[model samples]
Target chain A: MRLELVKRPQHSALFSAVSPFIALALTMIAGAIMFSLLGKNPLDALYYYFIDPLRETWSLHELAVKAAPLILIAVGLSVCFLSNNWNIGAEGQFIAGAIAGGILPVVFPHVQNVMVLPLMLVMGIAGGAAYAAVPALLKARFNTNEILTSLMLVYVAQLFLDWLVRGPWRDPGGMNFPETRDFHPYAVLPELMPSAGRANWGIVFALVAALILWFVLRRTLKGFEIRVLGQSPRAGRFAGFSASRMVMVSFLISGGLAGLAGISEVAGTIGQLQPSISPGYGFTAIIVAFLGRLNPLGIVAAGFVLALSYLGGEAAQISIGLSDKAARAFQGMLLFFVLGCDTLIHYRIRLAHSAPSKRTDVPQPSEPAEVA
Target chain B: MLESILITIATAATPLLIAAIGELVVERSGVLNLGVEGMMVMGAVTGFGVTVTTGSPWLGVLAAVLVGAAFSLLFGFLTLTLVTNQVATGLALTLLGLGVSGMIGEAFIGMPGIKLGSIAIPILSDLPYVGRFLFRQDPLFYVSILLVAGVAWFLFYTRAGLTLRSVGDNHDSAHALGISVIAVRYGAVAFGGACAGLAGAYLSLVYTPQWIENMTAGRGWIALALVVFASWRPWRVLAGAYLFGAVSIGQLHAQAIGVSVPSQFLSALPYLATIAVLVLISRNRRLTMVNTPACLGRPFVPAR
Candidate 1:
């Protein structure tokens, strides 16, 4: 006996739309089983994991804060992924952005001007874009694999950041700790409402970025080029769209956003350059990009969902004594289920007695026949 | 002093050689598993935990291999049976491994580990320069060399290897020839997983002999890059691994010698070298394309 995936004549749009929900449902079921195995009450664990995080005003603010970076990075990643350009080193770009944005506050700690914040943001974007261009240039000029190159850069960026904080950029009066001095008031990102919660302009930046990306991806000719080029580069070439140019453009956009996210994280929340600023936001955003089905608007919702999981993970850790590792495993499981369910959007799984006899409908040799 | 440094390089290179060789086979069978780092960390934690519990490094090694293989099976089920996107599924596998291993290893953290002691072959071990570097190394070091030799022969000389390569080169043709592409791929992926697990075990059991969160660090990723750097050849993987090992160890040595470069920059050397080697090797498109698994990363579904 064998099982096979038969390609659908046309992908089910409805399933494409609903697949994320299906995946989330499956993940919850799996999470329940995991909780049971861990000897926790499944209902209580589930509530803490999914619902409890959103119940409070403060938690909701935290959710927005966490979601800001994910949405920004995921939005950029959606553009890159859609164009078949993989930029797995958004983490590196994020760090670069933070480092770049921090130069003003770190080097000129006494500066106090309104333009400081705006200039820092621009520098952050530029830093990220410049860093991303390394892999982009390599892919365009030499056809090197972006996945490997981009990922390798992540470690480099990390080590560089570690070095700076521990050495050259270390604060003079920080009591020997490996961190920079706190940003001045003019350099810091002001909170949205000082009295309410910790949420700041980062969330606002995420929303604006999403809206702009949606317009660019859906209503513009460049958007059409990206969609066409991503689906079929050959077709894109015939349409006069340069794949190499798109590679650069997609990478720059993604890297720029990632950098923006990094600086926002530093200025808005951390308030200082440190050894570890991100909690894998760049990598987590990859999940968000896919979860949102690589759509900018969809990414906004997906970002919030993932952000909630991070908060829930903390909650579960405190309340049920669930290990942080378990929370990560839960996230990984969600991604696995998401990818599996996504397969259902384009293919139908069926049991077959044998391989050769079951695949008669597809006459084209180019199509994948049986996935068993 | 030089011989000791060489020994350190070899010890560092062993894990990479083992992991890359396993991945080489998986890629030869046309499946690209990007979760090597995740699997390696899973192995590191599992091996440490088991060794600490059982008081036997062998059991720890065995458990690590099993855990790694099991993790790969999850990947196989998704990519092979469910026909999920290989890249996405591989990344998910990695995330899952890191998370699960972290959870399982929480208790084991800070616990002292028993190292897998080196073997000494009497006169050979006592011999001057080459003695400690070769004959007196840990059992896994010799195993890694043998594994490389065995894989090189198996890939180039055996009929089964031919089938695996054919499956990787073009799965549809291999399927038409009754190669059982899916079965071969599953076996290959499992083999890769087991090797990755063994590498992880080497880290905790021999390298550091203690449990540390993410102790494997980015070595798993370096292994993946080594496979590409070798252009899918076993001998080249051996060379690449050792080169990487030297660069990694050399950085520490440089820092110790006060090379004036920041220790952080020195620490970043191995990763930077990986990028450089990739760029250099990939510059020649023909060489890369020739040895490259033609159907690599593509989801294979057997049909008539």
Candidate 2:
């Protein structure tokens, strides 16, 4: 008669595996509610929004074009996020990389060699890493908030590009517009299958990078060190791994990858450095990284799914008169729902002032942990 | 020239100072609410809508505080009650805030703002240099200064602030010492939200006297940077905000003076200044480790 029933949170390895699926389900349910609020037929709208677009060959290529950078950036970001070193300035790095990578093509316009393209790629990666180094140095040296440093640096990078496009990088012959000269034919990335739309070697790079990162994070000594550094700096220190050094290295790697993505973008698709080259791919990749739980392979899959939403958003916009802004709102909604569900997974909910007077009865039972 | 630049700097500093000081408090109490942008935009829209409806600037400010605080409560609920990752949750809140604010703000695009009037001083207004410098400014500017001073006092002098700081520095230890870490964080978050709202309201009602899409445009992010530059001190936040505001408005002065740099480069000035200042201040690890909130951006989950 005195037996007490204990209420404990359920923890299974399977739960971790299913979290993203649950989050996606929640997102769909929320999307349905939003659609109904807008007076649209939820199922029909959903079908057309996601499926109708995929049936198109052109749309498939566009999805690849969009997902290419996202996958590349998110893969790199997984490394940083897993190490617990946030580099929110990937957007800046991306911008800088584009400027740097595209510089050769725009400046030389006549460089007609295979080696030129490879050199441009290297330059782009270096450019992004250099830009990223600003925050990384400040972080490693002064203990500045990397999130802010990196973010603030984004505007600087952006304005610098704007300045370049309108000034030195401006095409003198191309009628007063703020864009770089067209990229050389040699600079362009060859299509994968010769006719797969925008699907090119960039996707291949993303996949390869994801695999390498996955291997490095899951099955390597450096990976183990990064995990330890993120989880506990004191422990990392005891293990003789310098936190600042890791911070620098992680930032360089992340920035360099983002740079590579930026160059790949300019060379692969648009073939020029245009203002607003990315639709916030660097920022969106943050969501992709977290949504896939920071696993490289998981991020690769997550990148495609998120890319679908972007494609589907455009589809809905054109068909149902939904604005591009609304599509952005939908993306934001997806991120929000995923975050909300993530909370549910990590912590169980409790009803306050209800039956069963336990610790969960009161409010704010779940709170943040110490930095350590 | 100096007078105009000084005025521009002061005007520019108002909203940012409000936000940075507010973030200082939020960070002090163990939360990194990156949703400042979202809260500010929501405040801007809510404030604009209220001002348009009631024709009262004061009510607009009040509306902003309410909306911002309400939005911030979402952050509190998630990190405090939901035990979510603080960084991820904060990012989500910012994105959600931006989307929702943008949606709500669509109605107010291109609307004219209600301009706030200044208090005319008698003697000080008549003086040459000191007159314009010390007197003849709007009530909000003065209030913002007082708010900074008040915040500085409250944070350092009051016992309540001690508890808040204790909670931010080490919530678990404070919890063991009989402090409600959850409640303190809630208070800090709400306060931060209100401040962000005030910053937003200032934008609509005073800064430009109109509502536009994404007008805050990284200003919230700038305010976040200012907090780091200020080293979590209220007075330092005021100084940092003014410095940044000066940098923002300096481009105008430089352009007017016909500086050789391109306008785009001039626009990049404030961002460059922010990076430079962050580097200067953050390089001192011992100082940073001491000044920065021990639990800044960390989520706390109580054991069962």
Candidate 3:
């Protein structure tokens, strides 16, 4: 039998609410199968992968730490994706932000004051926005494909980061390692509740960003413009929304947020600039954005879910000797199911035995007798 | 030494050429499968694994092609049959491919790989320079060139090619004309996947002859850029691939010669050159618009 999708008269609200949950369940089933194939007890592996991490205060803090960047970056991506601007190079932007933020700590270790941290955060956002501007400017000026240009920059950004930590930014006091100097106490992001765990203000930043963006997207004209431009550029243009300007606005917003995530990751988690600063948070955020259905509030929840996968990967690695790469594979499968289930929103899928007819130019659906 | 460098450049160019040509057809048929990187990597791992276990490069190549095509069918089923968002689905495919390949390839890591030896035409192998360059290269090298020529002919000169192009240019019209838009897209996507697989196979069997996680190393993406750089023309893809191949190999040579510049800068040349070339080409809006498929990246749902 072949699958046929009949368009629903309107988008199904029921499926819209349930698809993500359905997708998550499907992923867990697939993960269990994968674990069994690898010769582990599927039940135990699943528990460690999903439940074990949530039980501990430290792991929960770790979850917050991981989710902070994802929520922040994905919230930004939600804006870009909503506006029909595909900024696939957020990874590069994240690295650029980290490098930019690290400069204060690495280059000016003597500037150990409250002002330094604030200045570094500003610089990080600017750096990411500046990096993202390359593709935005290219697209606006030259009608270039932003997807390719943005993605290409990711490699450039990565290499630039590699050059920095190894070259000029290397910690002078430390042996010749590839990492830069550690941030001074004043430069480090203040912890949220150090007594409880290592969670910092990064999660607070993520929540605030999400709440503000949610308000903007839900209750503001800018959100309307992004939706209009995304669905129909012609309609958006007719409505006086400049597509080119929107490109810049959306890119800047997303880039700035991605930069925030990068710096937060460095100051909050890593505490130094290094040859590598992120573990593909930018890329993972893309998945998070989609899984969240491009809703800022939804992204906060999705971020925690994806963060759990990372934690689960680590937990599985320790307890079951499963490869950490399995986590990525699991994530990839999650996205596939998410997208597949999203089909339920717009159409009713039917398993049919065969086509009704082989003839071309069939009559309208209203003429039911023609098919028979 | 010059001949050896040329050979290396050709080897570098071949994978790009193969992958781009395949994607060119896919785009010409109006589907953008962004998972070329993913498919290529999967191909590399499968090719390496099969070669290691089965002891034949040909078998390895065959398995890679089949696996790539099979992997792409997941995309086909999702975007084509289920009508998921092509961009998101393609990204999913790539992410999944990378993750799965990394897991599978963990076993093959650091294992000595069996290289696919070059072809040796009895009389041609002995010639001073051009003969070896032309005829004494690996089998896939000739396949790459032939693919360019064959795809160019098939796309520009064949009736079937016209049908595929028409589908890409306007799927609604094609569907109205009784052509199976979805079927044609499935075929194009599969062909792209197979070529990507072969390119991945080339990497593992011929280029470096080993399994490295992410060895495709954004080459699949570079190949995607090459398609746009070529403006969907098969012949131009050949030129663009070599241009990139030369840039990449030149950087390697530069690093080997120990140029004062940082090795990272030298290594980043290919990606930088891609941006430059994209800017130069995309500056001519008229050219890009005229060549790009009208229905490219737009999902199609046929009405009953």
Candidate 4:
């Protein structure tokens, strides 16, 4: 059997709205089959993987904690992607942000005040943006492929972080652990509701960022510029929009957000800089951005869904002896479905057992229209 | 000692050469598959698992190749048939490959690996340093060299190769002339997948001979860089691969020498080198513009 696609006269609004949900449903079905193949009862695994994590108050807090970074990083990514600037190096920027933000508490341990937290947050945004600018500058100046350059920077960032914690930032008084000194109370991000769980102001920041970006992307001229440039560079050029300038704008926005996520994760969740601060949140945010359909508001919801998967992975591991790695696989499959389902918005698919019949009775798409 | 080091460098270079050559062909046919890392890791895990289970290194290599090609079909289906954004779809493939490979390789971790032995050509193996480097290397090293030459010939000399290149340069024209653009792309993608799988197998079966999670590391991405560095030429890819191999192996040797520089700094050299090479190559705009496949990464739907 061969798959054939027929172009629709216009983009399907129904599919545009419904594709994500269809993708999610398809992912769940695939997950169920995978669970059964692993010798677990499909229904039980499904519940544990999806529903059980949301059952309790503390787990809900955990979800908030996990969702914070994904949402924060993804909203930024939404801008970069919308502008057609692929910055896959947000993972590195996250690390750069963590290191930059931690410099305050790690190096200037005596300067504990109300100002330190805000200062650290600013430093983080600066650090992430600076790290991301390497690729952006290279692309703007030399027309380098941002995807490969950004990705290579991820490894460099990882190594840089490793060197920092193990070399310069190693806690001198601590037992030689590869981590920085714990943040003083003033430096730590305050918890939202201490009695419930460890969730902090990070979630609030994430929501605000998403809300603000949603407005900019929808209600502002800059948003229109990003959309126009991304959809058609030639048209953007004709409209006097500089693609290079847009690259810098989108990259800086995304990188700053990713950095904020990084510092927040460090100061709020871990309380210090360490050898590793994320569980692949930067890379995972790429999936989140796509799953969210490149809209900041959509990213907030998508972020929670991805967060649930991380929680579900841990839950399944403890309860059913499934590998936590399965969660990553599940997320990967979700992105595949998301991309595949998106095809429906522009084309209708037909499964043909033989060559597509060119029956004279069937109406055909008129001329090729001189596609460029 | 120098001979041994050279051999190690060759070992390191082989997989990158093989994978980059395949990708060069795929790009020549006008598809940019960013899933090489994903497909390569899947290959590594499958190869190690099969070799460990069957105790036949050859069979392991074969399984990795097939699995890699099969995994790539997912990418091919989404990007080619479904006409999804190629960049996004490629990233999806990488994510899925990493996730699925990690799950599949979980069982194979910590198990002893069976290393594939080098083939010794009679009499030629007896020569001093050059013989072992050239004749007594593992089977895939020779395959890597042959692949570069074969791909070079196929891409530049063959009628099918011209057709593939034409499709990459102008798919609409190819379609106008009744060439099956999608079919050619699918074939190129599968070939790239098979090469990536073989490269992954080389990692597990010969290089380290173990099933380590994310073992391919960033070599797959490096291979992608190599394709650009080579300007889509197969032989240049060989040169680029060997250069990277030296940088990587030089770092290892530096660490062994107990150089004052930190190990992590040394470990980061290859990635840094890739960035440097990319900057240098791309700085020459004419070089890139003249060689780049015109239709690379663009989604094509034949309008009837």
Candidate 5:
């Protein structure tokens, strides 16, 4: 008789990849029930969300438009996660970037040079990287909890940006609305193939960023250092790779990319800075980074998938009776289920009877089980 | 104006203090419980539900503690039984709690809060300068302070407390000493859950008295950080909680004072100060490591 509890075989290669897929399938099934309860047709509701809008050219561009920030943020976050640094303030960095970049155009409305837009882009990224540096510095110097510090800063950044639009940056002529002056034409991201619709330069930046990150993560010495650091800080120190330095580098990179995404979204799509800009893309990027397994190439795909949820959520809000918050719940459910399924990846479950009498009632396994 | 601000600070700090001290126990037992926000929100919802259903506010508080503990079991299962990463599981628990509570509390929106009357002491509460400070409070405020003191003593002075500290320092050694590691953690985590629930219930029944989505906001996260600021000491946690509460409520007061500072800058006060404090205290790596629970947030599976 086997001494230890025997696990049923589920660690086959098929189940490894199939687990995330199964989790996704379960999420959809659960969501259908939620929709039906909310008085929406499950089939048509699902079709309207995942298909109808995506069939058009304009909607395709809209997908890219929304996915740009998600992709950029997730890609940068992947690097930070790999380096074992938890930078939870990317949302704040994105807002900071928007404020910094958006401010440039409002302040320099008169300047229409060949490089004005490029200068603003730099300013945007720099702003994000600087804001990110605060948490990194604290983590590196004092061993403070980066997770809390970074997350808390999100509120501060949101308030800071909100203050700006409501105060010094408010468009004096805009009839008491809480928004800034319209970004100058030059500062706005030029549409790629104007006929393709909302497809702006942000998508290009996202793709390029993904490519570079994928290459760096797969090929470079620094990438290896980051991997080592995340896996074992003890080993990293033994290998002489400074965990503190990696913290600073990863935070800056992630924050900078998120910032670029912010500036692009505001100037490119919204055209003016408002009190509310992002729909929690920075926070959602955490899901993307994990979903993609912290791989840059995988992040590109996860970004699109998450973007669909956001777009679909909006669609459901209009089509179904679901409130804005219910849609958010749906998205959170997807994340929860996905994380739950990942549990089986490392550990296999087993069932065994403590009492010997139970073994006589049930047939034993045909052979010793081969799990993980 | 000063009295009003002081009252607000006291009121604000009560919840933060309660939540922080609860988290402090969880961390002291070497379990980093980040599901505070979720637990608090659920407590707020259930507490409000119970208060509205029954006329007594005390029942609402009890309801919160139960709900918080129940919600915490979700976190406990993932981190303990499944042995997943505590931080990731904590985040998941928060998101799940938010979704579930928001869903359940949707119907309770706009119901009036059952307000609790202040319990005035004979001479102290009626005193000119010190009455409000010493005697005028909802019973929960004083209970929370007692909790802090009780928790501090339990952690530092008791045999069970000694066992908890030993378990936190090294699970293997504690197990060697025959102090069931998982059992102690389960007890501490449950206790933390109860505390978090009480804090959340306090928000719904005592302070705001209305059900809202994500009303706890980031106070839970602030409480977690305050644990670090307090450096694992219960008394220090009390001080940290009030400090954060002061800055948070103080911002509104500062804005109300007609301070010329932009409302945004004033709003940023609490968060900015928290980050600054984190930077200041955490910069000393040695101090951070020494006081930080050695096995905090790591799952312990009995490796037979």
Candidate 6:
């Protein structure tokens, strides 16, 4: 008659390790049902979505390309989320990074030097960090909710980028289209290997960032402080850790990485700044961060898995006429299952025929409750 | 010109007021659902799709409310029943809504929608400058106003409102007092969803009268912020929504008038105003603390 979640004395480490796979399996089942409802062959649709993308060498390279920005952003987000700082405006930060990094090539087109690429990277990092500081400053100084402020800034950043590409930064010979001029050879991120595919240094950046973050999170004193602060702010304060400072640090790291991802996307893949540079990579990274259990190395794997879904979505669209919305829905389903499975890891579901009568023993259900 | 501008502002503010009032009640009941945007979009698509097919705006409005309520039920299951992380689950609901709506709305894109026409109240509608702006408007506009007043009275005067507020203020205390915390929260979330859906329907049936992918854009998010800006008060939500509506429409006027500012800057005005208001309000910590649901965003688990 009634169902309840009873917290476990200790979460099973084995289940925690295996939960993502269980979630993935459940999502696949749900996706199959969805495809059937859409009047498509579920097996063929699933294959195109989950298998066809990885069959080609070129698609594999494309997977890496898409995964790079996701991994880079998710790595930073993992730090922020782990430290109890929610930075939902990574999309804005990414755009700001792209804008900041593109300034050199867009403004002084004649500049040709080896320093251009390095300077652009620095600008991208600084731009993202500076943009992130808005919410961070508000949260620290005025106690404004970072979740809302950070999210609100995303719209501002998006509109700002739109203005730049349409008005001032529009390419002179672009036929009045909303986009910036393409970067010169010196400014562009070089390909990792011309013979293989279009994959570039961004993936390399993602890997290195993941490695560095893993070390910092697992081995450093600062990492311990972040963990302590996240678990209990009161205890963290007693241990001489400042919540305000941690907010700034986590935001800067997250924002800077997100910015780096933005610039890398422009310099490496897009080659020119446009009204829409990302296909929701910043937002998708939030899913990646959670899927990875807020672990840097785990995020690397989660990033690739999500990237595969994008490729699969495209593949399904071509093969079985799947709508882009279906792909997004599938991703959403994956996140839901992931959260659901994670809940199971922490609490066991119990069904009781009769409701309890006392407050001390599993607070009594007033009536028969449905499972939603 | 001023009257027309006022009408436009009122039209824009209507959906916001409806949605924010719903969220205010939900938040007051101690559940924070960030899926407003997702629910709104779902409402928009469903409302548009149904109107296009059924040829009746009322049916479309009804369909949207049901869809919104259904969508919120998913959130209720995950948060209240499954006891999942509220923030993550809410975000998931949003992603699902956007994706599912997009899929369902693919065929409806570019199709003209049936409008929910304005109601003309004879003499009241014919009054000089205030006539059309106040009396002659879409049925939903009046409903939004009534919603504000009704919610304000219910929250302040009704016993059910007090119970909901108590449940939100401290779930543990409310639980001990035999209040069905989960049931009250489910109702609150469902109400929020219905309001969000109605807002979305207003967009498709009255605002634009056509389906566009992500047509709700970020208004759902803006609605969420408006709740905080209003500090969870129904009347304050009305003022905040109108102010936001003015800022949003004012930016377009500025662009049309060729003000020195770039159109993009003007476009960002509403969001900027939200941040500014948040900063100003949050500066007075006492105000936020007093009104903010103490159990907001926290998972409620009954112990044995």
Which DockQ value does candidate 3 get? 0.54
Model 6 residue runs over 4 Å out of place are A357-372
Pairwise DockQ winner, candidates 5 and 6: 6
Q: Every model's Cα RMSD, please?
A: 2.2, 3.6, 3.8, 2.4, 5.2, 3.1
Model 4: per-residue lDDT, tens digit, A212-321?
99999999999999988888788888999999999899999999998999999999999988888999999899999999999999999999999999999999999999
lDDT of 4 by residue, B196-297 (tens): 999999999999988889999999999999999999988899999999999999999999989999999999999999999999999998999899888888
Q: Report the error of model 5 at residue B189, Å.
A: 2.5
Quote each prediction's TM-score.
0.97, 0.92, 0.97, 0.98, 0.91, 0.97
Candidate 1 on A1-372: residue-level lDDT in tens? 777777888889989999999999999999999889988898999899889998888889999999999999999999998888888899999999999999999999888899999999999999999999999999999888888889889999999999999999999999999999999999999999878889999999999999999999999999999988887788888999999999999999999999999999999999999999998999899999999999999999999999988999999989989876677888888899899899888888777775346446752333321110
Give the per-residue lDDT digits (tens) of candidate 3, residues A1-372. Answer: 878777777789999999999999999999999999989999999999999999999999999999999999999999998888889899999998888888888888988878998998999999999999999999989878788889889999999999988898888887999888889998899889899888898999999999999999999998899888877787888999999998899999999999999999999898998888887899999999999999999999999999999999999999989999999999999999999999999888987777733435432221000000
DockQ, 0 to 1 scale, candidate 4: 0.58
Candidate 4: where is the Cα deviation over 4 Å?
Answer: A357-372
Model 5 lDDT tens row, B129-177 = 7678668888788888999999989989999999998887777688778
lDDT of 6 by residue, A305-336 (tens): 99988998988888888886787888888899
Quality of candidate 6 docking, DockQ: 0.57
* Candidate 2 backbone collisions, by pair: A142-B282, A142-B283, A367-B299, A367-B300, A367-B301, A368-B299, A368-B300, A369-B299, A369-B300, B113-B209
Tens digits of per-residue lDDT for model 3, B1-304: 8888889899999999999999999999989999999999999999999999999999999999999999999999998888887888888999999999999999999999999998888897788977778889999999999999999999999999999999999888999899999999999999999999999999999999999999999999999999999999999999999999999999999999999999999988899899999989999979988998988887787777
Tell me the deviation in Å of residue A42 in model 6: 1.0
User: What is the per-residue lDDT of model 2 for residues B65-182, given as tens digits with 9 covering 90 to 100?
Assistant: 9999999998888777665677767777777777767766777788777877787688877788767755877777887898899989999999999999999988889988978788
Provide DockQ values for all models, in the order shown.
0.58, 0.45, 0.54, 0.58, 0.37, 0.57
lDDT digits (tens) for residues A1-372 of candidate 5: 312222333445665566667767887888888878877788877776677668888888888888899999999999997776778789999998998888777776788775878988998899899889988887777677788888888998898888788888899888989998898788888999787788899989999999999988889988899888887777888999998899899999999998999898898989999999998888788777777768888789888877887777677668765565665666666766676666667555554354322332221222211000
From the highest DockQ down, the ranking of the candidates is 4, 1, 6, 3, 2, 5
Interface RMSD of 1: 4.4
Per-model fnat list: 0.71, 0.53, 0.64, 0.69, 0.43, 0.71
Task: Tell me the spans in candidate 3 whose CA falls farther than 4 Å from its real position.
Answer: A357-372
Q: Please state the error at residue A164 of candidate 2 in Å.
A: 1.4
lDDT score, candidate 5, position A6: 25
**Candidate 1 structure quality by residue, lDDT tens digits, B1-304:** 9899999999899999999999999999989898999899999999999999989999999999999999898999998888776777887888788888888889998998999999988899888889989899999999999999999999999998899999998988998887888999999999999999999999999989998887887898889999989999999999999999999999988999999999989888898898899899989989998988888887776665
